[model samples]
Target chain A: MPKVTFPRMGESYRAFRMLMNDLGNEVIIPPRPNKKTLDFGVRYSPEFACLPLKILTGTYVETCMSGAELIITSGGSGPCRAGLYGQLHKKILNSIGFPVDIIVFEAPKSHPIDFLRKVKRVNSSRLSYLAIWECVKRGWEKLKYLDDLEKTTHALRPRELKKGSTTKVYREVLEWIDGAYAMKEIHEAGKEALNTLKLVPHDTRRAVLRVGIVGEIYVLLEPASNLEIEETLGNLGVEVHRSMFLTGWTRDNTVKETSGILSVKEAAMPYIPLCIGGHGRESVGHTILYARDGFDGVIQMAPFTCIPEIVARTILTRVSREHNIPVLTFFLDEQTGKAGMSTRLEAFVDLIRRKKNAPVSDNRIIVG
Target chain B: MKAYMGIDVGSVSTNIAVLSHAGEILADLYIRTRGRPLEAILAGLTEIAGLLPAEVEICGCGSTGSGRYLAGVMIGADVIKNEITAHAVAASIYVPDVQTVLEIGGQDSKIIIMRNGIVTDFAMNTVCAAGTGSFLDQQASRLNIPIADFGELALSSSAPVRIAGRCTVFAESDMIHKQQMGHKLTDIINGLCEALVRNYLNNVGKGKEILSPVVFQGGVAANAGIKAAFERALGLPIIIPRHFGVMGAIGAAQLAREEVEKTGQTLFKGFKIAGLPYRTGSFECGGCPNNCEIAEIYEEDRVIGRWGARCQRWDVL
Candidate 1:
């Protein structure tokens, strides 16, 4: 019966909460997304008007309506919109009459001390350590399952018979994982899902190029934000491997603490670290990761006014050429045209597949 | 007779310059980045290649700007530095005591605060276009003022009006409102300059110390209107160096000279850099549990650079 709220992604939190929580305090569901939520968002938000914000604004309202005194949240920074989301949420919630205490779980601004402060907020009375430990274990397990499943989906994307069938199967399996009772059950279920989907009988000899989509999680995740670049690429017979995962999301903290210059995650390296600064640094790091992971190409996805990604995109092209990986960028705004986007994706994939012998990045565009 | 080349690849423009030991521009080319810095850099280098001596004295190359790291590897730059350091080096040679440097480029803006000719603090608005040249370009187009006339018109404004300044949306809306209020077009346009400068001071230039002998460079410094607006905001005259937009390229060339004189050996691969066939790839290191993703850049088949490796460990290989 735990009341939990998270920023909306694909579907209603009401249907998803049964998957997010196990049994606990009563769940306080947020109202469905509407103009009222958008209004609250703009009124309270810092005029950026990104959609994930509307969901966040509503989450707070519903949490207050349900009278939840405690809230759980995390912090992020970016070469994308999510970097300042935590600060925006705090400000918006404060303005719209929701004064519920919010615990930002991911501020490692001071390393372990920040985390320790947040842990104290998770009901530090009796079962504190146990509760925190359990939460970490579960979250880690969830991320591993998610990354592994998604990675498997990426590998088998070229072989899936139906449109987004790998995604569809992965989604079903993930929903099952949320309710899964045991680790063995999760393992078996993952294997079963993979086995069932790999049997879709796709032609393995088509040789579709692999495209790595990297950028703000929202632009990369939401089809509309990215102008359906993934779908466009998939339709073009190019397999899309999205680089941002919950694992990368979690790993970004180490990048953030080092402020993008130092790889805090790696202690023994002797290279002169280039901190792109902020979450944009993570974008460069991840894009390069995609190149190294055998993607024939990379796409630096972003919105109209994003700062960090702009900085990161410059570096990504060099990385692509240096690595012989082709990169195409898709920057979206309200004016972004689907036809234009599809044309670009189709042409880019064709270029990569056709001219694997040519050179890295013979094409580039800036959506002004 | 040692010569060095430098490239400044930005999202908006690609600048290339080759300098002699005596600090003369032997060959320089400026090309609109047109959103493709790589293409621009390559094209510019190709144009300059025919202009240089076939067997020029060897020297190092350096690159710095928004596209520095990429330009570095592409051109085989011997040194790569941030715009603040590179710009400061070039500006210090020109102004010697530029305490403050305000640079407005196509998509990014930076404020470099220096003390005694050394950079102390710097802030940049790479995200906000309201304080950059793009803002001026949009305002110019929306107001129907030829971008070339935008500066002169601002100079004639009887009373500069108020613009929202915080965001381009509000600023555009405010401009429309001012237009409807019977304000002269020049006044409204001049007001935009004020609004942009005001917003820059309040946002990117906030809380940092601003000293005199200030120099403004970058692509936007060519606009006399912006220069005037900055002087009005600071109540002090500012200096615009002779070569403004390509200061980054100039800085790179200057840095290459300094490095070559210091190390007495240059890493510049040569003019054939443009013709070299390069290759690169990415991989995940299972060396440890981190499973760090790594990217390696190669020339032909030899590794030239490694990035995205969380630990420099892979780079050591």
Candidate 2:
């Protein structure tokens, strides 16, 4: 079987590795990105490309070094620049002497034969239809479990009795989910993960500030790209509710959108009315939804120069005004240092906390 | 008399303010940081201590500005807050119904919108220092005029010329071209002020509602020309607080008072720390591939606090 690799996007890569391994390919899981990866990415990629593309470029570079023969990444067809990143990455890699084939899983409806051929290349062992179905089902189930654990972790982080205990359990659960191979093992791991989370000592009566995170999917998922914003907020005693999860994203694009169930596009129609691509419409829609849900504040994070999010960010100011909720936008790039980001976040949390407590007609002085 | 102390360690200046329980500014001192925050903070503290009445006691202390963490750790701050919150607090407290706050400091500028004494929204300059006080300071020195005189000189302009206010690089070049074209010094100075106001409104103040009762407070609020330009641009009177330059410090003092009163105790290390030996240094931890640079604060050879690590391995507070 040929060695295949894909860029890391948070914990979703483990499920992707499982899928590729089940399809009979030697899936080389790329290392979790760090400063070195970002440095390599910034050095090789074009200066103006958004952060995700640069990170992915760095991922591909490290993946090639790990003896991966081919790269597989999802492709987009929209106004967002991500659609063209696969081709750009390929050319850049080829020029840098890593002559590897890149297979992009574009919308299957657009080019069914091309998609099938690319799939066959990875499924070199000629897995039967039943086997492929089973492999896909297992991958899907694992992704769902991972997303559920993450959602629970977000809710639990603010209320945990011991600081960082919930995160420790969450990390252990992630490893358990990653280690599980068979369907039965996966089921057992998921149940055990939930039970383990339940065991985390938490205060149900403690009032915590709630913040919703909405923006581009890549930055939202990849902690390395976003400076671990969710963790930072959670540690600051905030209940973070993010708009996108992998399973929800998968369902939205594949099944939900077509079936007219849970459509962010429709929710966004009153504001944006059209898909500007790269989760921008979803960002606006999610901000409105979060506002309607009475979240104290909404944070929109995007890589610098991401056209779609920029559009969403501009419109979000109006959404913030009308919804009477504070919105803070962060344009992430290589130069975005941790100290500065934390300062802004701390101030934002302070703002929302004060706003929430503003109804008290006296002794208006409040600080934490 | 009991007082709360606040120290704002900014990029350019270290401001120390002592406020009474009633929020009246009792004593304040502003010292140039000159790239050394620790010495500046210590000097400011000593000077502020001397300026206050000998009987006045420091009941609480807070720190703000870019170097807030360093200041907070050193002084044992009761409340360490960001510049945005500090400024908004000071503005709302001083003006009572301040709907907007325009604060331009050494390296950054921020626009804060408030409603009913609560900060509704705020924005700081993102990755740009073009329209801030430092640029104006640089241009003033380059023009052979003291920064203190730049504003008055601008106010004397009769026929102010127009300059592009998009980027600092372009603005500097445009200013030179205007100077070489034999434009009057005051005209060019006023023009520069207008350009900076335009750039600030476009960039940092973008998409923000600049309602009335705007309070302009920061180091740059000392500039009459910028104030005039802002008044022209927004068509509203800009209120510069009596302690405009040290409003961040004042806000910090207010926050400290609030926190100290609620908790019934202060974390202040006391005014005696001004004479103590303090040192700060950073080292790259090679524990992981990230190689995070860990910053350490030391008092007489013992590490008091450590931070900046992605992992909390060295985060001993």
Candidate 3:
């Protein structure tokens, strides 16, 4: 059966809780991510336990303790610490004296054997098939809505009257979206929001650049961790795309396993080729692709201690120069501040606008 | 007219090597991966294809490294081996008498001990990055020194100082403290080198039987300081091969050669893997009480591999 988990996210925890309630999987939802969860993971896990690793391991432990025979999760084995996390979690939990039965869905692009096994572990009689399936579809729809909203609103928000008001509204919308009950309601609300958003009168013809955000999932997704860089880009009239979403990650993993026996051409790239390997392959690939696709600039994001993204950022300078694209990288962690990130992004956006004639904001308040 | 393609997908970088039947590299590529290896492997293969003549017959294909399973699946690789085996195979092919293999990458580092051309015992630090190449990169950047010149900087030290080599944070802080105490740049840099060696020895190489005719590879091989430190600490003249950076690729390619030789055909899916739309995402696992945050990658809506599970029991499921 699918267990609900809040993980370590404070921003999305409540939303996940609400969704679990609506989906009727509220009983199995794991606790929110915390230092204790991380401790549970780090103590039992390998020395260099990343935050997500700790949370996942801790969540699995908690689920097993709750007498759950089978738990549900997704996994990948690739360049990021994330890919191997499934294996690491299993090892760590077993070593820590837990009899937790681990069930994971394979990457959407790889072999189905792992996921198939997980499905078997779950007693079909105990599972609410309708609820679980419905939850995923709804989640996908929500993702699509957010993706669409980001594309439309970002196009003009850079030139908005209040400049940062669109981002302000975006934050409000994300908060509300967490509580949104039905797809129809979200769509209706999104349309209404977009109409009101256009009332602010953003410039339609301002040339915009594209920025790719990559690195640790937590730092990339949580604005508090990364200083709301995506929103800052939006303010600068730059379209931002964050790699490591729920969909693409699944796709890459599904492809990675079975493809190994397929051929050497694709085998060379177990994750995302032409990108950063080891740590930040997505950022590296996204950077190159952004350049190849004619994006004016790329911004690489990561946590301070993350080696893979740092490696990718360093090599990105060579790629940036080789491809004649401007690349800026930021390292975020618990200690990161808004002022510093804003300053860097401000300069990077300015440089891109000048080189590519993509107008962006020069003045913006530091987001905290 | 004939060639072998090897793909090395690791936790840090993906490398592709195309070798002539006579064991000469026609072309090779190394790329740091943000988190995905499939794309990196494909990119390297595609690049080599662009640079090579289409008439070149790919006799065999091999995949190795941490992401070997996925790599083999994507490219239809004939041979898949653990990094230690792959590295040993490639090293043996180049220098059959190689007794040890030292590989330090971005996220992880390892030491493979070999005797009589076979792996004895190996220790790998998959969860630590204290002495890896990325650590060196960080220190060099903090010192505002060019990473390319990092090795030479340590080589210039007349009297090297010692810094704590236990972890990157301590080593960096100790270096800073040494700087505050007015140590020379060369000496400080050398201290950093010593720290790297100490960390590697104490951590990964702890009590391992390290014999020589050793080969050092991976990203950190470029650092002369680390190489020298290892030589001094081990009391052995360690040799680093020319294709150090792409050892994984070379290994992957060598494995490919073996596969082709044995199977009499190639499993390479070809070089045009670029058009495939790839995507990835993450979700917390709900299995058991262990809500493992699971990451899923997709290629046109299919699941490939699932890792990060602490329970290998999922495999049987």
Question: Could you give candidate 2's per-residue lDDT for residues A1-368 as a string of tens digits?
Answer: 78999988888998999999888889988877777788789989999999999899888899898888899988886788899889999999999999898988887766678877877878877998789879988899899898898889888888999888887888788998898888999999988988898789999898999999999989999888898899889989899999888777766554335432245566788889977989888898888888888999999999999999989988988889787778999999986368789889999999999888878545445787
Per-residue lDDT over A1-368 for candidate 1, one digit per residue giving the tens place of the 0 to 100 score: 33445554332232334334432434565554433454555456555555455546655775677776555666654234565666667676766676666666664654678787656545333345666466456555655665666566666666666655665565576666666445566566556655665665567777778777777666665443454466556656777787665555555554353333243213212221444434456566655666667777777776655676666666654565555566666566543324344434543554465455444432445679
Clash count of each predicted structure: 18, 0, 127
Cα displacement (Å) at residue A236, model 1: 42
Pick the winner on DockQ between candidates 2 and 3.
2
Model 2 clashing residue pairs (backbone) = none
- By summed lDDT, the worst window of 10 consecutive residues in model 2 chain A runs over A253-262
Per-residue lDDT over A258-278 for candidate 3, one digit per residue giving the tens place of the 0 to 100 score: 331223224224333553434
CAPRI grade of model 3: incorrect
Candidate 3: how large is its RMSD? 23.5
TM-score of chain A of each: 0.74, 0.94, 0.68
How well is each residue in B25-115 modelled by candidate 1, as lDDT tens digits?
Answer: 7877778888766567668888878788776674878997766766787776778766667787888878987899898888778787765
- Candidate 1 stretches greater than 4 Å from native: A1-368, B51-58, B143-146, B180-182, B277-317
